[model samples]
Target: MRNTAKITTAVLAAGALTLGLTACGSDNDNAGADAPLTVAATPTPQGEILTYVKDNLATKAGLELEVREFTDYVTPDTAVQQGEVDANYFQHQPYLDDFNKENGTDIVAVPDATVHLEPLGVYSHGVKKLTDLKKGATIALPNDTTNEARALKLLETNGVIKLKSGVGYEATPKDIASNPKNLQFKELEAAQLPRSLGDVDAAVINGNYALEADLSPAEDALVAESPKDNPYGNFLAVKKGDEDDPRVRKLAELLTSPEVKKFIQDKYDGAVVAAF
Candidate 1:
């Protein structure tokens, strides 16, 4: 009887060991597979869009989506370049090109990953229209090269300002050929433009920041970038050699999915537009 009891205990211990080993093997197999794909983005549309994906789509698709919000342009790209984050979704190609060139970072735009365009719009509190502004009325613009140029182009397109013939994406206030309103440009960081509206006659605010401040570009903008052939759509980006990372591919697919398209259309109300 004693021998039989000992034999039974030994068998039970062996079974437990086998079960534990199987469980550990399964966990090991899924360790990296289940790891989160962290992406950096700006708060309004980019962060909101990613949050939608994470809440509605990621679990069903088996994606562990994580989003980090950034207020400035420089950090997201640098984080990806340093492998601090898996991907980023805040910048257009032109801005990325300038960033890579200036910072000597190898971050690359995800292949075929045009996500959304946040049309740079001129917004104001003092005037209902761009034409209503008094001469020499101060207008604030983003100080960054890419957005400053874009803001100038928007002004030029609306006939508020004119550029030197053939002054392209790199245009600046110095490139303005005519300022019929004699509009004075106060150059501030993009994030600060919304707050500057009360102090300045008008401010050109990027779509994301504009949205964050509860200003709808579609309704509030005095003038906005025409979507046709606009090249400043924001996109997902990864480090150069990390392009083929499966997590990135999954996110890229999800970002351009029909569901995301509908979400953008419904949520932003034309303040944002689908680029893919």
Candidate 2:
């Protein structure tokens, strides 16, 4: 299961930092018979999936695949846009779309693999359950366009609020038609939502940042985005014309391999489902 959304974005400053392979050297070309093709990936599932390839698949493919690790969401897209990397295995289509729209660049998905589906979960601090909320409890949500709508939709589905008669993917918190609990919506930066958890009654958080804060989606989240009901499935991002790149195809193949699938099953348990 997956959850995704399209969001319009505001511009953020990014320095064009070139990430070279510390061990593999500058061999991005298809020039040498044994030269490596470099790909950039985010820390957890994407980079973890690439580690499997680095350890197992690259040798058999007659290629040495180098992966650069990234933490900030902005840098990978910026790196990809500058042609500093051949592929990136971090964002979903929505984030990619926003990054392109904001930056006026054309990074595309080379291989469409929803390798990991991290949900938006609402967890409480003082209250053990949602039923414990007072009439005017405050619940924080991500302020960004895509995630804010997602948080509201989740709240609506859980009977926490009521939205207008008919609204689609682009709906925002302003679309909420009812709020019986008088739940104050505290909108914060997605990256900061988890840190604010201790102060609020409950907070809706993205899974990556949750995990970064040492909260596992399978464990600490009170209620989360179930693949059974979400759209933002993460993917492999690449430059627009390079979808057919051989290394991209192979990397996607290896990621979806049974070994990787079982690894996800064993590691993340139910938190990060492998939608490969």
Candidate 3:
């Protein structure tokens, strides 16, 4: 689940300072090959899944895993790019691409044996279904590039709104081609959408945030992204040159193990789907 923590100027300054020190030889690349691989993850499925591997699977596979939980999106990638952590496991490819383009960071995904798709779900306390949404209903949406577009697509898929043809992941509220219900849009930070439910008619929430809020998408989402052919599955990621590190390979293997697939299926009960 995402937290509403302010990414303050001080935090950014501290991150820059850490980047400088990391370059002078304190990074994981210089550590012993068997050193614990620290992974930064969002708290819900990513952290919980890593913790499972750490407690029950890492030792037999000859891996030392340390899971560091982050409540916001920026820090995890920032921490990994700066070598403050060995890798991170919380973002989809689209978001990662956007981040790299915007921040001038060179993070890349570690190919997993399988991918896990966290479907963006539309949730509401006021309505039981999308049809129940009234005209002029206020809906909360993610303000970020990838997710806001993804959220809008979900609505379009459910016929809540229609988007311009060929406008897919790049679609924004401005791309909406039709809104028969005349719904109102309230765009907020992705991390803040879950909490905005009480203030709006409904909210389009990221799957991880929905889980952190204890909302089961399978049961509660008015609608969610379909796993079939979905390109947004989240994967373990690392700084460009670190992809081949032994520790990183171990964690990636564990993440795709049979036990992990079963854990996800049983725990999330379809809220989270394994890509392999």
Candidate 4:
């Protein structure tokens, strides 16, 4: 009962954004109350979570939902911005903020619609512990802005490295003030980090990608971000003015409902934590 279709970067780059505009038309047409609200999401937890809503909760709540899956992070926002999809559910605020500022896109979160938290994790095949990594060992990180800063923060938290004072979420390797082991870093796209584990000594991976790769954040991660007061809760987001669309509102309500909470807890265990 999963209503999902996968779109690759090639297709997106080949005028898929324009195609979305042609198909969905303007924001008003896309948000028509009777129409299905298409959402762009990454395949792991976001698409799966939305699929669960489509098959179960959405109908009961009088919503028609369609899910389109994308592997890369950038396309989903662009898809939403271009009206390729009505909304997206794959990113946290830091990422969204950076994307909007960088691309001049006006995507905004659906209010109070924070759904889940996929704790960022550090994983390795060669090392049993952070201290086990040898001098000059290379660790791969997500190359995008927010995630890279997040990865750096994770490393700093575990004492693997130290950043310059007050670098905050924008911290990068260039901010690293200390590296006791002189650990080298390989910056790759977030999707590629799990695959890079075999090549690098270790990698800090996003929770969703870790789940997609079948690495349990609860059991497999050497270290992970604590969810307490975490600002990275994944949520539903739409281009600027779609917040009040009836369909978006209904989906937002359903996304943060008790049913979705139970589904996340039961299906993902500690790998995905319900944020509502």
The count of residue-pair clashes in candidate 4 stands at 0
Tens-digit lDDT string for candidate 2 (25-137): 22234434444556776666667777777787767876667777765577677666666666778776667776778788788876555577887788877876676789988
lDDT: the better of candidates 1 and 4: 4
lDDT by residue for model 4 over 8-54, one digit each (tens)? 33434454446545434336444469777778999989999998998
Best-fitting candidate, scored by TM-score: 4
TM per candidate comes to 0.87, 0.81, 0.90, 0.92
Which parts of model 4 are misplaced by more than 4 Å? 1-26
Per-candidate clash tally = 0, 8, 0, 0
- Residue-by-residue lDDT tens digits, candidate 1, 83-145: 546788999988998888888888888887888999899998899988899999999999888
Error of 2 at 6 (Å): 28
* Model 2: residue 139 alpha-carbon error in angstroms: 2.1
TM-score, cand. 1 vs. native = 0.87
- Candidate 1 vs 3: which has more TM-score: 3
Which pairs of residues clash in candidate 2, taking residues 3 or more apart in a chain or in different chains?
1-227, 2-230, 2-231, 3-230, 3-231, 3-232, 4-231, 4-232
Q: In candidate 3, which residue pairs get closer than 3 Å at backbone N, Cα or C atoms, i.e. clash?
A: none
